[model samples]
Target: MTVIIGHNPNFVPFNGRGTLRHNEPLSKHTSWRIGGPAEWFYEPTDLEDLAQLIPQIPDNMPMMWMGLGSNLLVRDGGVRGMVILTAGLLDDMIFLDEYTLRVEAGVSCAKVARFAVNAGLTGAEFLAGIPGTMGGALAMNAGAWGSETWAIVQGVETMNRQGQHQRRSVTDYEVRYRHVKGPDNEWFVAAVLKLLPSTIEEGQEKIKALLRQRGESQPMGLPSCGSVFRNPANDYAARLIEKAGWKGRGVGGAYVSEKHANFIINQKAATAADVEALIEQIILSVEQQSGVRLIPEVRIVGEYATTKPFMSETPSS
Candidate 1:
């Protein structure tokens, strides 16, 4: 096992100088519950501590910023360098104006939605159904119904690899269907969201309705990423996969969800490889059968052991 030492001379001091964990299982932190291990993981106490501590780490170390781990898939071989988790720390939300709110990266989407509703804001009701932090939602350009996350974002605060901060506008990023493009080295710290003033009762009612609608459509109690593939233009990926006869197909313990064709479920002891293979199979099969190629909305990363096939291999008798 590779040990993750925290004595990198280049690293700076932060709040209480937190310890590092070696070979920490990525599965423990992710929603999918399937990943090998991370070389190093750190959860700093606050933004000031992180800002001071991050610049001290060596420049060559690979780093990934994670929030809530809702839409990520880390492979079994594990991540190479450092994984910075912001779930436990960086929790702050403030009202900047009647129509605007400032939220830290760690705030959950559900909380943001409810907060807006309580404050009599209407446009942010869609956020209540998303199961992730603001940072992840922003990175994925996550949306539901008719609204995208970027549509409400007026400005964002981001921190670079060197721990320097910058304020950027929504126009800085090239927003697409489910992808976001902006400064490569920066990670979201906070965001200023624009909302419309409305009745508290109306906002609350809208959120309740959206949540009920999601429960009816998605597999609510499964270990899977939300909507594995992005909708292809005006058509739905789930409909395509279902039409291609992949709904009940599986690789090892990972099976395509019968309830929702676009979802891959960890039915019985499914490994990361099984889930990943099933995802690829769905993409390829849909493309070969229908002429349209499907693209994944879930983000895949990390590595796996060489002996483990991503898909099932035939047994040697």
Candidate 2:
């Protein structure tokens, strides 16, 4: 990890609680390895430090939150203001009551699954294949093999940009497939999950099977967002993409995985522009051919260049 302290000119070096970097390369943070610099990148040391820093930032300055970058894309021009990266912070995991667990936002989905299984929890086995953090899983209602993040949700802890906190129930948010809409300007910091009881052996075998399925069907070795498009109702995005003959197509360095048509991989040196162009093209093609507009599962942010890459050419998939 690239850690540079006191690098941003606008950085206010308070106590030694966290690290700050100016013009931090977001490419280093995202899964695609393809983004420009962030004006100010802040990684809090802990949840306490993060909450403390939240209400102190300038009101005029903009901010964004992100996880492990498994399903996100930042444009080549980069983010303009502070990016509060939670990928490294908020990783506290504790087993609570017999049927409940407390997982901080930064904990990876895979870890949550393993921890739950070790404690003899059964419902979280589906999370073993998700590539992002629990916070991201919460944001997107991430799931696999018929289980969703919100399906097992019990209660969630949230904090507004202003540092105001709230403990909300599952009903507090409008949850859907690949979507979660809740309070404005409030992001997840932690969650309390209710799960079932099972033996560690059962959990381990289930996780292994899920992982094996993912490895066989997805491009695990390449750098790519886990899934580029949400599966449409009654159908899969991969099916639509393949029906449109989009498998192995690409924009610059970004190519659709042969293993799964819905995934875009960075074959070599992929730019954010390259990935964005590919996504737009795929959306257009799929919609034109099938009369269905596929919504992006990937969260795209930041600004793109006025001119695009030489995307008319293709890269070898």
Candidate 3:
């Protein structure tokens, strides 16, 4: 039996072991610390709990997945649907073999890198510099230090909206730089990675070097989504923005980082509209000057503050 709560038809109460919240502030979950509330937020306790809760959601209600919340921008009007948070709740990591490891979606990329290194594995050292969860990394093929998440992926387990699970191989999807296209209506639950055998000291050294390079280049202390735009073919996004003289440009409280032109930082109380406006301004100016139309790498979601009520029809209690 399903219980409808409050006046919102989409606000169905979850009876699972996980935590459920209504009107949760999305800014608290994102790296940029900018966004409106989420209509519904659910954090599953484990894989089994997640599977059980999937089918309980209303068919027409929208849903979205979140991890460490990097490379994401939620608009000011907030999300209209359920937001399933998998950051600390789906945490599970184990080795399938000497060189193969299985990591759940909630595991942080840094944790995966450290775990692999401690087990004397290489190739995952670059993950130490990625500031998101493994799930988010997989979704966007996140990369750092010249390596990508999908490069080491051997297989993955995905869960559909109907509480069904499927195991898929690398060939099941088209993986590109900072983008991935896979079976529709399925979200990744876990991934199997194959890494090269290496000494712990070696992996540690590589991770240290990568972190140093990132710290030197990025504004690590600021509230910003790591990279706002993807590099165009044969050129870098940061280079183009800097060449176009867009560094330190501001729109409201949001400004293009002078340290790295590809990053837009929130100095104080920056709204989603502010950041978005800044992004558009940069894109227009850069295209006008460099003839290269830069594409945003950040995943922008939710409704604009000016949009009408997402759910107008009230459900009878």
Model 1 vs. true fold: TM: 0.91
lDDT of candidates 1 onward, in order: 0.82, 0.85, 0.89
- In candidate 1, what are the lDDT values of residues 228-250, reduced to their tens digit? 89999889999999999998889
* Candidate 1 Cα deviation (angstroms), residue 223: 0.8
Q: Report the Cα lDDT for candidate 1.
A: 0.82
Model 1 alpha-carbon miss at residue 45, Å: 0.9
Worst lDDT run of 10 residues, candidate 1, spans 308-317
The TM-scores of all predictions, comma-separated, are: 0.91, 0.92, 0.94
Segments of candidate 1 deviating more than 4 angstroms:
1-16, 307-317
lDDT (Cα, tens digit) per residue for candidate 2, span 210-314: 999999989887899988999999999999999888899898999999999989999979888899889999999999999999999999988775534322222
Task: Point out the worst 10-residue segment of candidate 3 by lDDT.
Answer: 1-10
Error of 2 at 55 (Å): 1.4
